[model samples]
Target chain A: MTDIIIAADAWDEDIEGSLLTWIYPDGAEVKAGDVIAEITVEKLQVDITAPGDGVLSHAINEGDLVSKGGKIGALA
Target chain B: MTLTADQPATTAPARKVVMNRAIREALDWELANDPAVFLMGEDLGKFGGVYGTATGFFDKYGEDRVRDTPISEAGFMAAAAGAAMSGMKPIVELMFIDFMGVCLDPIYNFIAKHAVHTGGKQDMPVLIMAGIGGGYCDASQHSQTLFATFAHLPGLKVVAPTTAYDARGTLHAAMRDPGPVLYLMHKELLGLGLWGTMPEASSNVSDAYFEVPLGKAFVRREGTDITLVGLASMTHVASRVAKTLEGEGYSAEVIDLCSVVPLDRKTVIDSVRKTKRLVVIDEDYRTCGVAGEVIASVVEEIGTELIAPPQRVAFLDTPIPFARPLEKFARPDEDKLLKAAMRTLKHA
Candidate 1:
């Protein structure tokens, strides 16, 4: 089965220095624009959205120090 | 943009609504007053406004005057600054104050650094009317009262107008002023109005239109016992708690420190000296909040005049909640204010 991997496009100050929250849980059905995770850095925080509808996969857990070009979670 | 050809300098008396609505009125007035005055934001035109601030604005001036933008507050805010430098009075909005993180690059890197770095030869005439939403279970994403964040920054005139009157007047001033002013218009009080149909700030708005002069403090009430400070929506909250204290025979002087960055230190210091006690009723979280700065200023500037240590009636350093009771408890409501005032008296 093919999976969709949502990676960090860029860093958001809102979520700059904190953990990223998965908007949808692992193994959950998701839709476009449906958020899966949140990250906070310093004084910013934002929820990353699901790219496409699929079964969920989490490559990064909550409170993980995420950087650009890192795979956060996957959708299959 | 389009030379803003719509109404005459004095035309189209719109509906007077809430403080925020009066702000809209002020923007409309400014656009008519100066071809240089324009507004840009995400969903500002076709969507009527993210918060209805630009309702009927698009139909009035069309695209040229009311410019609609993509969801890029950082890029657009800088663009507003650039527009201001090129002689345009552009009013931009960040859907919520929490979104400021997305736009601080423009705020600090340029707006704050430009004038001085340019040897005081540049003019950044941008008014950012950020909708600072909180206290209404907008949840953590939207409910942070970030006055302290912007207030801590220099080269930014941060004004949190609590009343509709102050909102319209201050917004007018910020729009016309020759600098980057961050107008933290509260999202909570956008629904309040003076009368059924009229906004509280409708009357006594700019005759020129008059801009609310900067660096002045408003004494919400005149009392002698304890001096309490409030800013933005907290001014309303303090007035209510002051009344509760008044019934208990404690005369509390409620002063609204309307302008935060260039604070009215003399007014606050003078009040503390008289009352021999001070409690800052702030909307920000404790620990390095506006309260600490004001209190420290009073102590350092006038150390001799004191009856008690200062108290900060502010939210704990935590995100606001969605649960009703948790939200209420997280904020320093009337009960906490009342108790803090009495605690100061004990030290007195």
Candidate 2:
């Protein structure tokens, strides 16, 4: 199994982190480059895409604050 | 930036359009007619604006005039200000009004105060169009409609149009007028196709070129019992409240103060004197806001004639909350305005 960690990309004003929403639920199939979730920041909305095709499992529930560099999900 | 090309208007006829489309159509007119006019903002070219106001603008104007800048507000805002001074009329789109803080220097000291500071010799024909207001669970940072903040500053004309007709005319006036104009459009009225159904702002827009003079108030609905003042989306809220109040045997005069800086004090004062009551609804913070200013102006002008203390329905002086219920509680909605109107009319 490979971990799908939230990218550690630098963000401006990520003060309150982000509320997470999964586009594809756990145990669902996703292809590489598919938009799998969304993270809404204070002023912007960004999509989290699948790094590779696999069966997915979420490390955090919907509406959870996925802090920068935190593990969001895994692919097996 | 293209230096030499004439873009001419090809379409003609009065038509019904949503507020967002009306704004785009206005921009299309300016871009088509004026060779010097160009639009600049982050993601405005390909993304067609966050509110979809510039959806089909990029292909028509191309990259030269329909330019996109990096996410740095201070850098691009300064550039736009400089462009304005150099004879190009630049229409800058600050995606969210909340982001104005990142570029205050250019907005306050330069873009706004330039023409006057230069003894009226230099022309700064720059217009900033920004998306404002809440009710979308966009959190504190993204939700505020800061009309008071800009209107308080010197040398800038601030305007907010509630309907598609007003939107078109106001944009035309802003573009044609010299100096700086802060044109704010409520996000809920933008027709972005993301949120649920939105209330329709009047689409009785003229197809031919026309301008709604700034510093003028539009008496949206006439009444004689109590005067209700509002701006932007709040105007629509007041309109609904007026209808309900009419049903309850209260005549509520709804006034849309289109521009805050050159406030139409005469109209408001005139209405208040006739009605003997006032209710100001503002989307901004209550303390030191547009509502307060209007109330102060009316009281200072005709305090003796007022039968009741002016009531204000405004956002509490605190950061807007992210939660849906909290946002609703904090914002001045239809119910709140109705209560305010009733309070004003019933006052001893």
Candidate 3:
């Protein structure tokens, strides 16, 4: 399984973001570089893309708070 | 690395937002445009509200406009009423609908009855917002959706929005109205990450100012077999059950009663007229709740048109329990709604 992480370097370290929505539903097929989820940090939204092609499984639900470098979902 | 400014990602073209953001946007727009509009609540400034609905207002509009108050609901509520009477629009946020018990006097007596008592000389344009809902084990005190209780009072417009789009629009409408408006925001639907998300409640909301006219009910889904009427969180439950019933060859129409006060009897009556079956769902207590009011209104208007006896799915008339199992049992759910719909269908 390849983990989809909200890269720590993407935003300020002190800020916490929320997983706004998962563009693709859980257990759906996804290709590498597919924008799988959207997270909002400090009113700005950042899209998380799939690292590798596989079935997408969400590690957390939408509206969940996330820190930098967290695994939002995985492709297995 | 792709960060967009206040916009949803390009991959998903729709500008969908959760209810919390939608409410904040509406408040921001009002605060920027209307000098008379101000906000007062506990922890509204800096803390950004309990549900994060007023996240950056303190910085955006300053403390004078986004004022935080002591933990006295009665004091601030009375103050808000006084401010409204003096030609100021005050948006007061009572953290929980359950908290209204301590401040009911100022609300019902002064705020609600100001215009009528003064013979239309004074207009109470106070917009009161409160959190309502129970699914995440917040216990009885913090969770009851007392929609009917507020609606029972005279001269108060009660609004309970189900979607982010409606939340924004209805809030704008409530603020603009020259009368007292009670806007109840469901805790679970706020998308605050404290409770699980209800994706169905989130929708594409525009950034521009808009108003969903007060006293109108929205038909979420159109069908002919049975009509399921719900408000706030119950609307979601009704919609889910409607989808499930559709698989079994049942067409269930879902109506979201956006405002409960001017209770849109026409929408309910029209939908029931077509379907000939009615199942009203509400999270509030069963006795004298919105569910009973809706059923009574429908039957009163078109008793002869009904093919089956109307059913109501609402919270059992008891204080909401803290236990997860008991809370689940007490509140209305998809199962209860589905069963109620089936009971209506049995007569057909």
lDDT string for model 1 (B157-202, tens) is 8888877668776776676567778888776666422101112222
- For candidate 3, the TM-score of chain A alone relative to the native chain A: 0.93
Which candidate leads in lDDT? 3
Candidate 2 residue-wise lDDT, B78-186, digit = tens: 9989998889999999999999999999999999889888999998899998988889899989999998899787888998888877888889888878889999988
For each candidate, give its TM-score against the true structure. Answer: 0.74, 0.79, 0.85
lDDT of 3 by residue, B219-238 (tens): 99999999999999889989
Model 1 over residues A1-73: C-alpha lDDT tens digits?
A: 3334434555533233334344445676767666455454442333466677777777766656766555666
Task: Give the winner by DockQ.
Answer: 3
CA-lDDT, candidates in order: 0.72, 0.83, 0.87
Ordered list by TM-score, greatest first: 3, 2, 1
Judged by DockQ cut-offs, the docking class of candidate 1 is: incorrect
True contacts kept of 2: 0.00
**Candidate 1 off by > 4 Å:** A1-76, B1-17, B192-208
